[model samples]
Target: MAGSNKDIKVAVIGAGALGLVTLKNLLEEGFDATGFERKSYVGGLWKYTLDETTSVLPSTVANISKQRGCYTDFPYPDDTPSLCASSYIDDYLQSYADHFQLRPRIRLNTAIRAIKRDDANNKWHIEVAPTASASDADTETITFDKLILATGTNDKPSVPKIEGMDTFKGQVLHSQTFKKPEDFKDKSVLVVGIGSTAGDSAVALMGHARKIYLAHRHGAYILPRLHNGRSIDHGLTYNLMTVQKLMQRFAPNVATNMFTKFAQKIQDTAFPSIHEHPEWRLSPAPSLRQTFPTVSDELIPGLESGDIVSVPGLKRVTGPNSVQLDAPKEGDEPMKLDDIDVILFCTGYVNDLGMSLLEPRVHPARNTNPAWLALPGSRGKPLARLYRNVFSLDYPDSLAFMGAAAFATPAFQLYDIASMAVAQVWGVEAHNTSTLPPKAEMERHVDEQHAWILEYARTGPVYPQLTKQFEWLAWADEAAGTNVGANLGWGAQGWTFYLRNRRLYKLLTSGVYTPHLYRIFPSEKRKAWPGAREAIERMNQQLEDELKTKKV
Candidate 1:
């Protein structure tokens, strides 16, 4: 993955965590990079808002632990709790921005409204605007050697176009706009979507609302965030190479016993309709994609207590304050919910990347089903056709995205690597394999990634197997100089760093693939960003003064 540096001038859209890391890294690597944020701040989706751009719910917490959620270079403050709140996420991002001096390169209240290409030089012409709001400002046309669309999938609400949606007399909202469960007080609410937001809404709204209907087509696995008081995400480190060895050489039942013990500690919880009749889980497909064992802990408890009502996928909007619900059994007659007050579609985002920005010749995410594949008209949504989930298949290094996949893994960890790959793909950074492949080769990779993402979306919790995500990160680590995926080493104190990860190191070396004893490879010397040491030193001094980090 090597290429010649073109002294590329890059414009990154949406300065969230992904944008911050990317702009910071690109600047350090000596690229003429500038970041444009539609909002007045640096944090993107992580920064919760009441406007149309909001992505996070007020009650949101990282489904994964703080250890798993953080960037490679910066650690969360020790005071930060496990399974940290999104507010802390906001803080962590701000801290990263401050550490890297990213603000200077970032233009707040700026947006890339549209994009065009300079066919002659293989560059991108980006249309710029001052605000994401209705107040029209003088639009400017600017050009860049490359563009990174880090505007995440979560911002845009993927509301399904129901027949007679406007006819509903009651309020209709997307989970993106939901702030508190208390808002739906005494009203019967149908919370749509099946991811963490839906789970949080259903569980929180229970007992508060007159009745809570957890709507879904395909049922998802309702998982607990904390198992026996420890974050289950952090517990994944138990995947030891020695454990793999035992499963292979001496005892096959070892794996079974391990799984049972883990499962015994966990419980199977689903919407009551699906839980009571396991067969109905098949009706709403793409339902299982949102259900991981650790996605939402409160969903099951809420269901069991009769606090949340369960309904099949929404079939049709029959009238104002009325809708037809699909039955648990596919061919069964649709049931009618005549008294519905608020319909909160918990459905996930559609990442229709740069429809206005990208020319027709270039491909964006082909599957743009922003409704998270729940509706019939998902043809135009933003499930992307990205290469290795980073670069665009049609445009290669010149056009790319960060944090594209709707993954269950720690996001910033993934986004950080994708950030590095942008530089790697552009041949702007020196690494062992820094060459950008030919267009055909890049397209082939995109096709391969497209298939993998589709499969992951289709197959449920099995995708949460951390090793596969590690393999993906390893691909990013190859591009970035950080060998985190290579062996999981970052700056930490002594055995404090490697003790917990010794088994992870062994597991990385294990040859067995199952059941995810996935493959990993040694990386060549991770080339540092030009003058990275000095940059880090400055960051450390600033953080020491700001964060007051203790010196061991």
Candidate 2:
């Protein structure tokens, strides 16, 4: 169903980084696109708020380097810190909106009330209301030919139900509600979970809280932001995406072993020796295959300095302001933590699509297939059975989800490419419809991916976006017809393109692998920017300077 962009109208929800990019791509493709954000301002989670929205903690810093964190065409300002703060991220996003002139089309303080697709007419009927308006009657209906859900994966906070949490009278707060360090002044706090948020909050509250207990059942591989005096993403991990893909494809066993060793080396250097501590009840160190490593620079030092007390899994609340903990070791006595003035859960967010925004008919988990319904950890949790975690299997043509997947790499370019793919598919029928695989085939791919994830995440709720960077990038490139792999000898030209363009090929292979590389070559549906090469060179030179001044 190739359609002229002159008549196509697209509705993009959530004007965060992801949504902004989607709107930009849709507009560039000549479609009439409008963005709707529930919050009064843009920058979804990056915009810190006291409300229910999940955002960065006050001490949050860029785990991924600024170079990788930026959009393809728009690099972060040269003065931006190596590991910039959340405020810098927010400002960068706002600047992006301003640079693209996207503010005029964005409707802030507008929340999507209901979304129902008219099957007969092949159109979306979206009911929107003022974010402050509580009444359903104060809504207006708008029609669009296509819908893009940029609402993001981290909007809803996932708070765990702890036994006897009701009895704790002091204070209970999720990381989403954590305002500032002063709020916990002189208070004995319990930080549950060892995710990035947990580490950041515990470190941030070091001097503020009188006592801080960092609780987790399993041992986490907490990596430092810097590896070898450079940001982790600026070095090996960022440069090895294509290499990882090739090795995994050609020599799976060899690649797995090498990667395991590489990860172990990083863990040995970055993570503290807390794993061998006699008092803490952290479980055995899990393999990289089991879970992703958390990036934190100060958590280990804080633990070692006795600023943050590491404890075992919480059993239950023995009494108000007191909690019973599991034994440090088997047959060891259980520990009790008392005088806890505040309990802060640093648990991650949920990406379930069962929110009231969309009707059940177009729900992300609308598929009735038994295989699709059997979600790991979450039996009935609604997840989008999306192909490549972007296109809705049920309505791939008219509906898409941006920034749905989390990866080891940066999200800016990944979502940008996804948006481009969506544009190509929706803008021209021959570019996508005729080239797209059948729905059944797409469903089968989704099922296989879910099966792979289920095998690893057998216990906890698996977020659908937990995918490998290389695999997802390859899939997105194929859909967008970008032929990014061509330079790497993984496409039609194979290795010939490397010879034809040695300078660009060398940069692509050995350089910093910045986000701008995605915009280096023009495609049928995408035009390359002349500044892409300059951006890449600048980033590479910046890295060289950093390496010269700093010692590993």
Provide TM-scores for the models.
0.77, 0.93
Flag clash pairs in model 2.
2-429
**Consecutive 10-residue window with the lowest summed lDDT within model 2:** 428-437
* Tens-digit lDDT string for candidate 1 (65-119): 7655666556677678767778999988898899889898888887666788888
Q: What residue runs in model 1 are displaced by over 4 Å at the alpha carbon?
A: 1-7, 132-137, 238-265, 268-294, 330-332, 366-383, 428-433, 451-471, 484-552
RMSD of each: 7.8, 2.6
lDDT of 1: 0.63
Each candidate's lDDT (Cα)?
A: 0.63, 0.78
Q: After superposition, how far is residue 106 of candidate 2 from its true place, in Å?
A: 0.3
TM-score, candidate number 2: 0.93
Q: Could you tell me how far off, in angstroms, the CA of residue 239 lies in candidate 1 after the best superposition?
A: 5.3
Query: What stretches of model 2 exceed 4 Å from their correct place?
Result: 1-3, 237-239, 250-254, 275-278, 281-283, 353-355, 366-381, 429-435, 459-461, 490-494
